[model samples]
Structures are given as C-alpha cells and as structure tokens.
Target: MRASLIQIAVDPDESVDSRRRRAAALVREQSGADLVVLPELWPTGAFAYDLFAAEAEPLVGGPTYEVMAEAAADAGVWLHAGSIVERGAGFDGPLYNTSLVFSPAGELTRTYRKIHRFGFDKGEAVMMAAGAELVTVPLPEATLGLATCYDLRFPELFRGLVDAGADVLVIPAGWPERRRAHWTLLARARAVENQSYVLAVGTAGTHADVRQAGHSIAVDPWGEVLAEAGSGEQVLTVDLDLTGLGVTREQFPALKDRVLGLAEPRR
Candidate 1:
C-alpha cells in the first residue's frame, strides 16, 4: 500500500483559514496514494494553546472537516486529515484534540480524540478533555490504530490497539524540535514491540515559540525505517508491504509471547 505523510509547517504568520486551504490542496495532490496522512493540529498550531478557543470548530460540518472530506474524494485516497481543536456541544462543554479519518468516497469514517493531552497542568492538559475510547479504522489493505502526539509515549495504548487487531498504527504529532530524537526512538519502539507498521507524522516550522520536529517517519513491522522527512515542510511517501507485517510477525513471533494481566509491580 502506498502512503503519503504531509509534514506541514505551522508558522504563526499563516492564518488558520489559509493553512486549512493549503492542507486540503496538499491532500488533493496525492491523487494516486492509497492513504494520505497529515500532522497534528495543523489547522491551528498544536502549541498555540492560546489560539485553541479561537480556532476551535465542531466535530461535524466544520471548515476543516468539510474541506478535507472533499480533498479525500478528489484524491480518491483514504486520508487521515490530521487533527483539529474540536469544540464539543454547548458553550461550556469541553474541547477535544480530535483526529479525523475519511474514506475515498469523502465519508467520515472515524474520529479519534487525542487521549493524552500534552501539557501536565497547563496548555492542552487543562484546556482539553481526554478521550476515553480507543479507535481503530479498517481499510481494504490494513486496519489502522489511531493515536496522537503525546499518546506515542505510552506503550500500553499501542498494545491495546494491537489487542484489538490493529495491524498499522497511525500517529499524528506536533512534537517539538528539542525532543526530536525521542519522537523517532519511540515510533520505532512502538513498531518493534507491536510487530506492526507505524506511520508517525509531525509538523514542521515554529509556532507559539516552539519549533516543531518534522521528521515524519514510516517504520515496518521489523523496526526498519522505510521513509523519513527533514526539518522542514515535506511530503514523505512510501510503499508499504502490507503482507510483510504478517510475515515478520510469523517469523519473529515475539508479540505472541507477551505476558498480559501481570500483577502490579512491588514498590
């Protein structure tokens, strides 16, 4: 299966509307790809916490959703349209860092609200409500486990997806440039541990004084890096051997040895 990961630059100078339009155009450009993925919070810079409320949109019929749905149909590809700051129902309702998936028919297939908020007590942690459910989307070629940004650091989340029969893990992030190494390391680790394909896409450039780590990457089931982007806006495209996932798992058979439901560790 062919996949295109668009590492978008989320600079402060670009207006949210302009970025949304640009993102849709980029998605439309990947006409022949089987799947196209974008970075997290590309519409209104992830770290731009102050702009979250101002740029927040509804889950359905929002500008980002409308534009990306059309782009998916135009490109005829299953598109992971990154994430948006979602304003839930009612004025006082919570906001969610939500990721959207659309099919080739321009239909909203699934939405994964980010489970792990970035900030500890401030920023996203306080601003957005955590998503309780784990989401997986089934495609003709592979089943995708959805995750976003900080969720990558938690191995248990990926393991849960694997338990639910996800073969490919798709992670959209807005990781800072300072911790770029961790981003790459963790992505490969998740793939290796789960014995599944991992596509981790992140933003580029700077916003809210934090520079984004743009090394969007694709890792195979055996922890091989197939493709990676640079520290700038780029579209990293790779052809994934969907069958290789099962082949590697069968050859290695490590995941089958996992010991689940262990007792709590002693203090």
Candidate 2:
C-alpha cells in the first residue's frame, strides 16, 4: 500500500482550525497515497496539555475530525487522524489521548486511546487515563494495530497486537529531540520482534515548552528502513508490502515458538 506520513510542525500559536486546514491541504497534495497518517496531537501541541481540556472537542463534534473525515472521503483514502485531545462524557470532552480512523467511505471505523502515556520524568502524562485496550482494527487492505508515543516503550503491547493478527502497527508520537535515538530504536525493535510493518510518525517544531524531533519512518518486518525523513515539515511516503509481513511470519515461524504463557503462582 502507498502510505504517507505527515511530519507536521506543531504550531502551538495557530488555532486548531488553521492547523486542520493546513493538514487537509497536505493530504490533498498526496494524491497517490492509499493511507495517510499524522503526528500525535497535531491539532494542538503535546506540551500544551494544559490547554487539552479547553481545546478538546467531542469525538463526534469536533470540526477538526470532520474536516479530516471529509478529506478522506473526498480523496477516497483511509486516514489515521493521529492523536487528538478528545472530550468524552461527564468531563466536558475527550477523556483520553484518543486516535480515530476513518475509512475511504468516510465512516469512523475504530478509535484507539493511548494505552501508555509517556510519564517517565514528567508527571503531566500521568494526569490522563491509561488506555486499556490494544486496537486491532480490520481495514480493507490490512489489519492495523493502533498505538501512540509512550506505548512504543512497551513491547508487550505490540506483541499482543501482532498475536491478534495485526499486519501493521500505526504509532503517532510527539517524541522529544533529547531521546530521538530511543524513538528510532524502539520502532525498529517492534518491527523486528513482531515481524510486522511499523509506521512511526512524530512531529517537529516546538510545542510551547517542548520541541519534538521529526524522524518519521516506515520499517519493514526485517527491520529494514524503507523510508525515513529528517526533522522537517514534510510528507514522507513509502510503499509497504502487506503480504511481506505474512510471508515472513510463515517462513520464520518464530512467533509460534513462544513459551511465555501465564503460569500458576508459586504456593
């Protein structure tokens, strides 16, 4: 499939509507892409977590989502709208760092909340709810597992996604430039261990207090870097072989040789 990853610049100063417009234009320009993925919190800056509750929109009510859905429907391509500050019931809006997927037909197929929030040093991440489920949404072209930023740190989540028949892992992140090496290493590791394609998309530019290193990449199951982009506002495109993931798994059979099943507790 011809996939395009948008390494967008987080304009913390720009209104969400303005950024949405720019994103739509970028997608429209990538006419040949079958699927388009965006960076985490593209509408707003990740470090601007303080604005999340106020800037958040209901999953179904946001103009940001509507615009992307319309764009996907118009272009007849699938879209991973990356991460958005969404509002849920009771709390006014988006309760989690949620991502939404839209089909070519403009139908909302699946929604995945970030399973692991990146709260290692900063405690702001801990302010949000930890998503409990690993999304393995079935697309017409392939079955995709959805994850975001810090979730990349947890190999078990990707393993579970792969075990659940995921052919590709879609990860959107707002990774810092300080730990850029970790971003690349973790992404490649997931692809190697899971034996599936890993699409890691991150943002560039400063987000109020933090700045992200944009090195969006597409890694094959063999951990080969198919296509990579530097720290810039660019659309990194790559053609991925969905069948290769299946073929590799069949040829190696390593995934079947696992023995990490649950064990009885010692008495």
Candidate 3:
C-alpha cells in the first residue's frame, strides 16, 4: 500500500480553519496514496498551551473532524488528521493533545489522547489530560497503532501495539529541534525492536517558540530507512512488505521470549 507522510510547516499566523483547508488540499493532491498523514497539532502549536481552550474541538462534532471526514472522502483514501486539541464532556475542561484517524468512508476509526504528556519541566502537564488506553486502528492494508509525540519514548506502549496486532505504527509528533537526534534514534530503535514499519511524521519550523525538526521517516520491518525527509515540507511515499514481516518475527521469536510477569528479588 502507498503511504504519504506530509511534513507540513504550519504558519503561526494562520487561523485553524485556514490551516485545515490547506491540509485538506494536500490530502487531495496525494490522492493516489492509500494513507496520508499530517503533523501533530498543526492548527495549534505543540507548545501553544493557551490555544487549547480556543482551538479545542469535540472528537466527532467539530470543524477539524468535519474537515478530516471531507478530505478522506475527497481523496478516496485513509486520512490521519494528525491531531487536534480535543474538548469534551467526559473531561473536566479539555484534553490538549489528541489524534484521530478516518477511513476512506470517513468513518472514525481511532481516537488517541496522548498518553505521555510532555512536561520537560516547562508546563504541558498543566494543560492536558493524558489518555489511559492503547489504540490500534484496523484497515484493509494493515493495522495501525496510534501514538502522539512523547508516547514514542515508552517501549511498553509499542509492545502493546504489537501485541494488539499492529503491523504499522503511526506517530504524529511536534518534536523539537533541540532533541532531534533523540527523535531519530527512538524511531529507528522502535522499528528494530518491534520488527514492524514505523511511520513517524513531524512538523517543520517553529511553534509557540519551540523549533521543530521535520525529518519524517518510514522505517521498514528490518529497521532500514525506506524513506526519509529533510527539515522542510514534503510528502514521503514508501511501499511495505507485510508478509515478510511475519517471516522475520517467526525466525527471531523474541516476542515469544518476552517476560510478562513480575521481576524476582535481587540476589
């Protein structure tokens, strides 16, 4: 299946509605691609905590979701509308970092509220609610494990996705420029350990004073870079071999050897 990971450079001045319009257009341009992904929180900056209240849209009943649904139908392909600031009734106020995926039919497949909220001593913790569940959205081509930026650091989550039958792991991030090396290393490490395709998409330029490194990548089951992008706006397309993945896993059998129980006392 053809996949297009769109590395968008969102303008700080652009309105949420305007940005959504442009993102929808980009999705249509990559019409032949089976899955087209966008960067995390393109409308509101990743560190723009203040905008959460202003831009927060409900999971189903909002302009952002509406746009994603429209784009998926228009392109006749699966659309992963990177993420939006999700505001809802279940929560006290709103959830800052959340992602949503739509099928070709525009059906809502998965909703992932970012489990690992990035504090880094700054203050994201004060802004959003963390998700409690791991999500894997199934498609005709492959089952996609959903995760936002910081969640990539947690190995258990990726393991859960693999156990949940995720063939392709999708991460939409607002990774900062300062820790870019960590981003690349972590992505490659996840692919190598999991033995599955990792499609990690991020944004270029600065957001809320934090500069992002836009080196989107698609690592194959063997941890080889199938496709990669620079620090700019680009769409990376790559083909994956799902069948070969099964063969590799069977040969290694590391997953079967994984210890799931509690640890023993130190000697």
For TM-score, the strongest prediction is: 1
Cα RMSD to the true fold for all candidates: 1.0, 1.9, 1.6
Best by lDDT: 1
Query: In candidate 2, what are the lDDT values of residues 5-120, reduced to their tens digit?
Result: 99999877778789999998887777688889998988887778777777777878588778888888887888998888777776653368889898888788889988787767
TM-score of 3: 0.95
lDDT of 2 at 118: 70
Clashing pairs in 3: none
Q: For candidate 1, write residues 127-233 as lDDT tens digits.
A: 99999999999999999999999999999999999999999999999999999999999999999999999999999999799989899999998889999999999
Ranking by lDDT: 1, 3, 2
Residue 225 lDDT (model 3): 91
Model 3: residue 218 alpha-carbon error in angstroms: 0.5
| Residue 214 local lDDT, model 2 | 91
Error of 1 at 200 (Å): 0.5
* Predictions in order: lDDT: 0.94, 0.86, 0.87
**Model 1 ranges with Cα > 4 A deviation:** 265-267
Question: For model 2, what is the C-alpha lDDT against the true structure?
Answer: 0.86
